[model samples]
Target chain A: MQQKLTVSQLTKYIKQLFSYDNLLSNVCVTGEISNFKLHSSGHMYFTLKDEHSVIKCVMFKTYNRRLRFKPEDGLKVIIRGYVSIYEAGGSYQLYPEYMEPDGLGDLYLAFEQLKQKLEREGLFSAEYKKRIPFLPARIGVITSPTGAVIRDIMNVLFRRFPNVVLKIFPVMVQGEGAGKQISRALDMINKARAADVIILARGGGSLEELWPFNEEILARSIFKSEIPVISAVGHETDFSISDFVADLRAPTPSAAAELVVPEKDALKRHIMDARIRLKRALAGKIQREKQFLAQLSKSPSLRHPLDKINQLRIDLEQLNKRIENAMERKLESAASRFSVAFGKMDALNPLNVLSRGYSIARSSGKKIIKSVSDVKKDDMIEITITDGSLMCSVTDVMPGT
Target chain B: MDEVKSFEDAVNQLEKIVELLEKGDIPLEESLELFQKGVALSNYCARKLDETEKKIIKLIEENGELKEENFGQEAQ
Candidate 1:
């Protein structure tokens, strides 16, 4: 007979046993998940199973917080942890610390890992790859001959830039032998070397549908392509190895064409703008030169090289002649005054006056009486003539003295 | 088409022309030369746009060989 113990005591004993279980702490278990239920409380409960075995597993809220992908039923996962008993239920289970999809179940992880590896290798470097020609004589497309990817690309390229020469290199984009077809298309086109750039595209699909682009062979081919490759394999969220290896990765097939060719409308506008700028700049330069010439031509030195000096000389000569004439006139006037005074003195001399036949008389203390009445009173008088002095008598006098 | 060069070569040449013009130090004679080059580049770009204007109809395989089909309009 066994001794019965209280439920709490039994639970405590089981909890202590689980804490000491070293083998349960860290373990790697791979099996299909079943009975999967995620509680609203943010905890995950499930069972791990294979052909004839199953084990209860619990991913608690804390550990589940680290999961990058949502867990679902029928998914095979590789869990890390050991089997431990819950004290409250006395049930034994695998308490997972971490989990990953079995056999690389997450396609996104594979895509990311490949992307990172390729990036580190510099396969997608802009330096190593050539840019798409601004004006391509021809653009070659490699995709499924009948898919929206090609149509979208074509429509956009046509709408944005019309009259583009597109050569389609039809190939299978999915399923068996897709990698081969794509590789063959690339090889053939490069050999022909007709197109300026190559665009490889496909519509968005499930992971299986996009598997062809993930093939290592296809990625390698894109890297080695002689013509620049633009990979537009799927939607924005979907990425493949081809995307990283190609010269450029576009979010969609339409976007790839946009990258490959220049838009007609935008290009036209750009050309117009460039033309305007060129003309403006040239005209501005020419205008500036003309203005400079005009300024130089306006200078007085250039306009009248000799006239200014000649005019000054003429003015100087005129001033000099005027000064000389004024001085001579002043001297002549002074000489005229002196001559007049001399002439007067000469006239006053008796000898000069006699030549003119004129005479002058003056009454003295002995008066000369010219009239008969004056003769009676006449006394000694002096008289003067132009030639000589003589005793004189009074001459006949008019009435009314 | 005769002006067509490698994409990288053309882009590099275009960049050089832009730089020379931007410096504004070129003589009038040299500036005219550079302007001519810039015109050629713009023309090349126009030609590229013209080339893409042609239509490309994507096709899908209904049986064995691929056939042209419209997108979002059909179920495969």
Candidate 2:
């Protein structure tokens, strides 16, 4: 018998052997990269090597796509992965899900790494950035009270615009707990609604000194702020995570303050200019009205209506005088014609013929009969003349010879 | 940068005045009132700036008691 064993017993022994063999699994390693290659199929293969030891690593397509920066050989990296046996090769390797650049100052490396990460994520995009208010009423400042940063900001703000109200939420700007403290200050300011604009500032300092501003928590706080924030940490050259997440970035604390408040002098000058414009416009309007009044006064209807009425009155008077003269002449001519008719009638009157001695005598008056016929019979005569009436009795008869 | 209790109120009032004046339809009596209020707000803002002179005041926190440290010189 050759040590006959059951199948279960053999498998158990193999499993136990693999379990106790701590040569692989759950390791944190730091090393420089070597033999790094990116496959067209979207897989990453690299070797992590130290002075004496080396390990093979693989980052699948999904994980490789999330990397902030490209990985190259000779660049130091810190990796965390679980060691697993490759089923095909029957070898142990690292399947790293995350890696970070090494050898950079802890803060600087963290800053660059986070900045790159966020830039890829589009957190610092201009489309998401809010425009600063032209004239913020209240400004909140988070900084160390005793530092020159606050003093510089105050000086510049007062000099430029004397009206902006500044609320100081004093906090430790450096040291171990600065990040959490800053986050708390930001929360308090937001809850209080103490300001419309925020200035997160600190004076220039070394990488370690400015580390707290690069904190992820602070960065998130700045990103979530309802009020517009301006990060003015350190000098112009120094960049921090807070600068990326903030709505605006200023070179210095004083510059941040300048950004928040509009200059009073410039505003006053604008107002003065507007005032002048308004006055000029009003004057022009008044002048236009005056011209309008002048034109109205000169209108022919108003100026000459009375003259037309007077002229019409004179014409009426002339017509009345002509009518009166024509009426008088007509009456005189009518009277003269009546008088002439009266004279003509008088000329044809029998009394006028009688006055002209044209009457005839009758017998006498029959005594003057033609043959004097017979006076035998007593004759009575009646005679009529135009001037007077005479009565006579005719007692004789006329006889003709 | 001066620390004021009611900055928003002052600024809002100032803005209202500006708008009213710009509308150009204000009654003559109301214009005078608005002008007076504007002047008051302007003076208040100026005084706030003046109040923040350079006073080197120290914050003393001894035994958790916060006290002001006043510098000898008065800043003008």
Candidate 3:
């Protein structure tokens, strides 16, 4: 100012001062947020203020993605970042790297944040869950090598289904590197194709002890497993992130074993019942067939097959007798008609006149001489009787008056 | 009673035979054959159940090769 420095030069000098100050370079601020605005470029601009003062804040998308809760106006929060001056505006603002709700612990907030994120992504949707195998040939277990959880599971599984194969993958259930170990075991199981189904299990413990199960890495691994996963973590009341991501959830490790396989005695009873039903069904089928055969045998056509032929023979004989009687009547009527015609012909016969001693006289040329005028004196004549003919010459000529 | 057949297969076949017989429309000779096969399958399943014993084995990686060891009371 004493040298009459330009406005841009003064702003540059002040920006360098804020950037170079170690205390101002990194800070933790606790205040109520106000006038929060998230730009289209994914950069957030807000004002963090207390009763006495306020400071401008900006969080890029890179840092905003790391925040667990939604940042809004009037919400009290803690921000850890550094102060930087914007040379163009000549204003210093907090560039936040991390942010959290004021009253919540980091772990709790992280859990909620991850849960909400995965829920929104549909990872925990019912449609994503695979159906657990009814009869798994091999069951893969991921848990502590030496623990009541494993022992209880083994005992229950062996008791229920003795023939089922169980493969245990020893893993650290809690503490440092536990999440990575659990995740690796799942990957190994899937890669090896060692089991038909996987059981992710742990005994009852406090929230801190059960932190590995809540890890995002383990949850994603369980969600992406090719084989169905049954999560059995802690007591009935204890719920973990694995439980929500798994295909099936059992209250305890022993309960998981029980749910995985059917009881041998129950299966045996079922088979026996099936056998009984099979026998009954077969017997009923045979009985039905036998009745059908009996009914067929009792049918009239089959019982007396020749009866129809006998009736047909009787009908043929009656027809033959009627035909013979009709032919006899026709011959009798024909013979009587012939006799009637013969009697009538006999009455017209000229032989009957000859039988009564009558004769017909004819001239020599076969002409009949009915009177003496037809005959000349001394002419020859023929007289015909019924059986004979006579030739005679007339001795006297007489004319009939 | 094929040795290679699984108990589950045997039980499934037995159930199918029962269903076939229950329909009551098959020839008598075929029904008899199915009944005989069903009886055999039932016997095989029962024997399998009675004869099976619990076996627990542990898988270990030795020299990058998976090996099986008998897991018994000693581990417990």
Best by TM-score: 3
Tell me the deviation in Å of residue A336 in model 1.
33
For each candidate in turn, the interface RMSD (Å) is: 5.2, 6.9, 2.9
Estimated TM-score for each candidate = 0.52, 0.52, 0.72
Local error of candidate 3 at residue A101 (angstroms): 3.4
Residue A199, candidate 3: Cα error in Å is 1.0
Q: Could you give the candidate ranking by TM-score, starting with the highest? A: 3, 2, 1
- What tens-digit string does per-residue lDDT give for candidate 1 at A177-199? 89777876776677656567888
Query: Which ranking of candidates, highest lDDT first?
Result: 3, 1, 2
Enumerate residue pairs that collide in model 2.
A363-A366, A364-A367, A365-A381, A378-A395, A379-A395, A379-A396, A380-A393, A380-A394, A380-A395, A381-A394
The better candidate by DockQ, 2 or 3, is: 3
Candidate 2 positional error at A127, Å: 3.8
Ranking of predictions according to DockQ: 3, 1, 2
lDDT of 2 by residue, A1-401 (tens): 69987865665565556556574445678898999999999999989999999988898888766564567799899886666655456555788877777866444556676787778888788887877876676677888876588878878887887655666666799988898888777766676566688889899999778888988789888877888889999999988888988999998888898888777777665555544444444445456666878999899878887888898999999999999999999999999998899999989885787788765345654443344553345555444466764555546656665
Q: Count of backbone clashes for each model?
A: 22, 10, 0
Model 2: docking quality category: incorrect
Q: Which residue ranges in model 3 land beyond 4 Å of their true spot?
A: A1-109, A125-127, A329-401, B1-17, B23-53, B60-67, B72-76
Native-referenced DockQ of model 2? 0.09
DockQ by candidate, in order: 0.18, 0.09, 0.43
